[model samples]
Target chain A: MTSELAAGVSGARMIELGRGECLALLAGVPLGRVGFTRQALPVIRPVNHLVDGDTVVIRTHPGSALARHTTVDEVVVYEADDLDARTRTGWSVMVTGRASLVTAPWEAARYRALLIPWTDRDVDEIVSIQADLVTGYRLLR
Target chain B: MTSELAAGVSGARMIELGRGECLALLAGVPLGRVGFTRQALPVIRPVNHLVDGDTVVIRTHPGSALARHTTVDEVVVYEADDLDARTRTGWSVMVTGRASLVTAPWEAARYRALLIPWTDRDVDEIVSIQADLVTGYRLLR
Candidate 1:
């Protein structure tokens, strides 16, 4: 149990978020960074995402580098945060899961409705993550 | 070599950034996300950073989970971006390398001068990534 005094003295308090709360926070943010490994070296890309049910979907070019990085069963991490530097307060949520393409025509169309390509790219591919673990933290001042 | 027409049609054009240019963009941003593997699962956390002559140094708590994940010569990725959803235009930069503590007392103090913790945490650990690859792209509408 972290005391309010200790938290106040540090000017930042760390609070853990439950699984459901983490999902809600993730759903609230539009932009997130996806992390995966390429050549055994970790790589991360910033992209916009949509939370549908328990899975997260994102649109990208079929020929883009992202597709090459997380196509089949690659494990990836998606993270979003709304932190304020001045107040030293905000929340961050991260979801870890396996990424796969949405190949079903009907499902693709449905997902496309929620996740739109922010940039003018073909964005023909929809990558959905079957989240395995979700966690979050809130920094309070 | 992307054509102007394609960019105009999609309103999101992708342009690659030069090495120096990418570093400049990185310096401009106050925070970025760090990606690494924990128990074979990829994880990420947003952090404030300082770009030294060539390496990136970040401050973290000694007991924080991140310290446990990155101290062992594990390869990591650091990323930052700025995109406007309305315009679908912005820049994204990523750096990949190994993370280790800044053991030298003087180096740690020097880095502390540049990178300050936004929240109240011990933040006594200085993790530095020796970037092996630096890449970036700009989306123009």
Candidate 2:
């Protein structure tokens, strides 16, 4: 197939993923950025995450801005990417979801076991996003 | 001071930085992620960047996906982050700007002298983004 035809087919496939597939891709990646609002201004930060069923789980401290913004039902945007420079082939998935602080002991413990940050930072709050809209796209070389 | 008070003050400071302070932060960082759409799907990859006045400059191969997506007048998002795991302190800056392929011979040579990727990757296309909206925040311990 021509490059144009291939791109058309890929575009159709991307539209089909809509939200669920995007969530899956986001779950597979360990690193992503969470875009939220801090006092009406946009704040974006890198987060280490895990996919627990349909929710995206992130760990932070109680005093962290990430913890404060992610209350119980606030809307936020999350993005994750997997790319290869060699072939210039990769995909990025974005999830616009409702964030909630996971206060349940058991749920928090489970997340604590799975999602580990690459730093020795304090993690007192566990935030999870129940995605409302998930979208993704794959770039073919 | 109590942790609560510190957190409150830090949150306010972070919000201020998120509004306009990102321009300087963007200039200081050497590496960042360039986000673009390929086949209508969002893709992001790590790249070495240079600050040329109010624009972010990065180079790629002639036939790279980034080169294709970053046509003249195309809007793209460029993000850079500096994180310190010891204190759990970090900052991220993002630039949503218009991208164009750099063709000026002397300008391209100047960029070649400053921005060099740490990998043996092929780079033939030089792209620059004139920042339209810049936002960022720093996390306090």
Candidate 3:
């Protein structure tokens, strides 16, 4: 099937990861990069995230650009990986979804308490990305 | 100056990185994520790269999507970071540039020898992104 491609490298092979495995690996990692279009160009930022089922959530300060700009329905890309540079063997997951600030008081408050942002800034905004598409790959030896 | 911003996080502060420091940091890292638009949506991929002056170079197989789509003058974003997950302290660099396949026989030959793909697949295409804009930040404790 054209579903994936495998290529060998120094006894290691690249494999396409399934959705279930991708979500599990994402939950295990605390940080990832978020990509969005701004000024008609792509922008990426490193942020810590939490996986709620298939949705990804992140906390940010109100003063942050990500918080100010992502008000409602912003299509974005979330990526995280645990690859070792020296070994070049690991897995990376990419999630494409629409990001919106969590406006519901209950959900926002719960995330604020559950997810400690990588930055120590006082975070007042929680952005939830509903995954529309998920793709991942792993390098195995 | 609007050139930079600083925010405190615990005992650390987030500071904007200068261009010189950004380039130096990128030169030290071998891998990064490249972002480009596909079908009006943003896509991110983790690929190993080399910093040549203000340009970033990557090798991809001709069969790969990146090589097929990025024929010439495509705007793309390249991001790389070195941060600790536990401490969340590190520097991240984001570069905006026009990516084009290296067509010159001499240049392609040189890069083909210098930059090795992380995957062991046969790679025949060399893409060079000329950095038109460079931005970076560091979380320091």
Q: Residues A24-72, candidate 1: write the lDDT tens digits.
A: 8888878888888777777888888988888888877886555776665
The model with the greatest TM-score is: 3
lDDT of 3 by residue, B24-67 (tens): 99989888999988877788888888999979998778866677
Candidate 2 overall lDDT versus native? 0.67
Better by lDDT, candidate 3 or 1: 3
Looking at every candidate separately, what fraction of the true A–B Cα contacts under 8 Å does it contain? 0.63, 0.02, 0.41
- Per-candidate Cα lDDT values, in order, are 0.79, 0.67, 0.81
DockQ of 3: 0.35
**Chain A only: TM-score of every candidate?**
0.86, 0.81, 0.85
TM-score on 0 to 1 scale for chain A of candidate 1: 0.86
TM-score of each: 0.87, 0.55, 0.88
Model 1, docking class: acceptable
Q: Which pairs clash (backbone N, Cα, C closer than 3 Å) in model 3?
A: none
Identify the runs in model 3 with alpha carbons over 4 angstroms from their true place. Answer: A1-11, A63-65, A120-122, B1-11
Ten residues in a row with the worst lDDT in model 2 chain B? Answer: B4-13
